[model samples]
Target chain A: MSLDDLYQSIILDHNRRPRNQGPLEGADREVHGHNPLCGDQVTIRLKMDGTTITDVRFEGSGCAISRASASMMTSAVKGRTTAQALTLFDNFHELVTGAPPAGTKLDGNAGTPGMSNASGESTDVKMPRELAAFAGVARFPLRVKCASMAWHALREALVG
Target chain B: MHRSDFPLLAASPGLHYLDSAATTQKPAVVLDAMREFYETSNANPHRGAYELSGRATDRYQAARERVARFFGLGDPDCLIFTRGTTEALNLVAQAWGRRELEPRDEVVITAMDHHANFVPWQQIAIATGARLRICELTPDGRLDMDHMRELIGPRTRVVAFPHVSNALGTVNPVADIVALARDAGALTVCDGAQAAPHMPVHFDTLGVDLYAFSGHKICGPMGIGGLLGRRTVLESLPPWQHGGDMIQVVQDEFSSWNVLPHKFEAGTPNVADAVGLAAAVEYVDGIGLDTILAHERHLLALATDRLAAMDGLTIYGPPAAERSGVLSFTMADVHPHDLATILDADGVCIRAGHHCAQPLMRRLHVPATARASFYLYNDESDVDALMRGLQRAAALFAVAGSASD
Candidate 1:
């Protein structure tokens, strides 16, 4: 695909004007990620209400891919149940890593189109579905690590 | 360097190839040897009673002997084939480091060592609980010999440093460093990855405990390299890997490993690539090392002179720095990646970023650098293309930065 497809307008918008930024101190969990390839660094924070994610924010120094991904992730998962949020993480990870569940079409929205909404309603968030834009990103091998750095660091925080 | 000998030189759209420090282009002779091997005696080495195996084994052993003679060693027994410099260093880490290392015993390493040399020691140190002490580098990328002298005391058991820095391209005085390391009673390991490709290397002259160099970097085939250590050193280290070929006898309760080279080499090795490497080394030998070193020095002097003249440029290393072809530099405000991208657009292949030397990169106080390395194959035209590429990078990045603003 072209740069236009990879750096879609929405991704660029998130990169240019990130949604949740700066430090979130007193956060239940905080994680920092670094991509040595392009020298991208990010610090993500999860402010939780008991076991649920009450708020999520991040601050980092990185390229467009990492910054946009972090912003999108925090916005998508804030106020999510820890377990529910983890499922979203697993799904998004599969799309980026090319290990999608069997019988799932390669199309971006073929399986489980969007993340669950807070009202217990399901809205088809295009940003979450746009993750397949990174499926091609994974094929490069080196860039796969760059795309996955944020989620990997998040997992480290929750687990460790 | 003559372009007629190399077809890639004729095919690449333009010049400014500074990545030979990573890997050099194959000479006409090296290519011919590979072709001759495949066309004539392509067979598994040390396996069957056939003319092909005999010829193949002859070619493979000749390469080992060639390496032994090239390093002025007494026997080919000292030369062990490995994947590359990384594995060679790691072999010592596994074989020697595993046996001798004890808790609280230390491996004295230099900060300037390439990660290949650094990480293996780090891992082995972690596994053995042998502490790791690093000798720092001067701002000019020279090993702080004083620091090495101090750090490598009686407690220090191993000392590792590159004979030449792959990133800064500063050539170290191995003989001098080895003397100090030896005085401290630590076995010295020198990384010859950048050294062997550019200049003549004689391990006997350096007198280090172990010296490792890769074939691919010297226009040889990939997957073939040499680990030159004294036979006694080899004897002391345990066989860290195991399987067929490396063994002598196997019983229900006990097994014995093979001798010297085969003990280290546990399986069917890269027969073809080993033959190809033998050829590559022979090609270098026929050219005469004096001619090769002179050609590289002449090209390096010219290229570094051209780069030193650029405006707003910051070249890392001393003026008249004891350098090989690898030259790392930075330009005002233009990131190395941006510079590399612009140069790539003009078909100039150069290495950007940390060169896998993160600590050294941090020492330079920059995110990364644009590196232009030279090889014997590169000529004035290639260096000129690099100069033009840098100029293009400066202008285009300047324009792009302003336009983005």
Candidate 2:
């Protein structure tokens, strides 16, 4: 019963009907990320319009957290600049891992300011509401990798 | 069951541990033996000249003798102590494989083997320019004997396989396979990491040229294991590691290696864990290996029956009669990782991954599986808890208006 915090309705919904869940046709950049420990793999494909990600899609098989994260990630990063998506990755990472990416500040615009962390205390950077469903991942340390599998692939695809 | 003998199981009344294939819980006797060794005979073995060092050497030698006797080996000098099965296999692969295998030589392995048994041979094959051939598995998860007979030929120099598959729990016919290798003039290396714990394993009877097993998997302490090699085979290879203990004469330009087991065991050996492993062997012997095997078979049957009756679950491996003590499966809607998490919430521990048999998982067409392995400590209640937890995972993922909905 206590697993409700980790597996929210919205997350499960996205997992059941994943958006952008197939290979993107005419995609310019594609990157595959796999966690050899769990065998969770995510392939992120992007159709980049200059510096802007005009279209994004994913293809892979994994747990609900990873699948749903990839589903929500595609919708969240579509039509966004490469810089904005990287910023969102930082915020999403901090939300689940309880720590921001090393050597980078969480510049505003990833979430609503002054949102509460898992302990009901206000945090410096807030997470987008849909991504906030994964904040409970911080409690279950092992699932953090599952939550961030897609985000890591996206970061790799963008930077490379 | 002998659950009470293990301190951790005795302390945690609510824990239902089904992950013995990863490593078993150490009993109090094994712990006490290590503590006793440290308290009384604490000194570096084979070096010190004082009385304490003599006692330490005696303890270490006595452990080797106990281990040799337990595994039905005639010569204790053939047993080389290692950190675990990984190191032992690496030693064989590096020392024997590098020296014996020529560019056109062939090495045979099975697809269902754990990476410990598979990778070392792969690396050695690459290093030596030898051909690495893998024996395929049957649909029921047993090794395809036809494929094996085809792979092992005149050029096959070394054949390595697991006695019991860590992922599928398929118990291999060790002596039969060893005979095939012998007929082909190839040395056989058997990885007994998964088999030595739940069942009786006799090195001399198995007829394998080299055998490796881990202490932690056999309810012994970690960081200590033994590689049992034939006397002639052990003498034919070079020493794996160099330094303190494995030398006979150190010259300015060249050095001569020690004989038999000492030639393989270099540096300060893990004396205390070795003593602990011997005590573990004694404790297991006290319980009777036949009784342990029977108990685990009963548990495995119960688990298999329950899991088979479950609507959405599909169990891997051969029939319950063919398997040792492991049950690997997958649910329809829930991922293995998610299923493991749900089971853990109910204090039921199961392993969920590729189980270090990535090639086997690929052959099975599943990325990973959920495995629940039985041991001497487990009983019917543990199986019941596993069922309850699996049902919880199913309901959470499938039922309308449930948490997922």
Best by DockQ: 2
Task: Please list the Cα RMSD from the true structure of every candidate, rounded to 1 decimal place.
Answer: 4.9, 3.8
DockQ of each: 0.14, 0.46
Question: Which runs in model 1 stand beyond 4 Å of their true positions?
Answer: A1-31, A36-39, A45-160, B308-312, B403-405
In candidate 2, position A46 carries an lDDT of 98
State the C-alpha lDDT per candidate.
Answer: 0.76, 0.90
lDDT by residue (tens digit), candidate 1, B216-277: 98789788897998888887778978988888999989899889888999888777777778
**Alpha-carbon RMSD, candidate 2:** 3.8
Question: A36-135 in candidate 2: lDDT tens per residue?
Answer: 9999999999999876899999999999889999999998889876766777888888988999878543344334565433434333332357888888
Whole-model lDDT, candidate 2?
0.90
Which 10 residues in a row give candidate 2 chain B its minimum summed lDDT? Answer: B396-405
TM-score of chain A of 2: 0.85
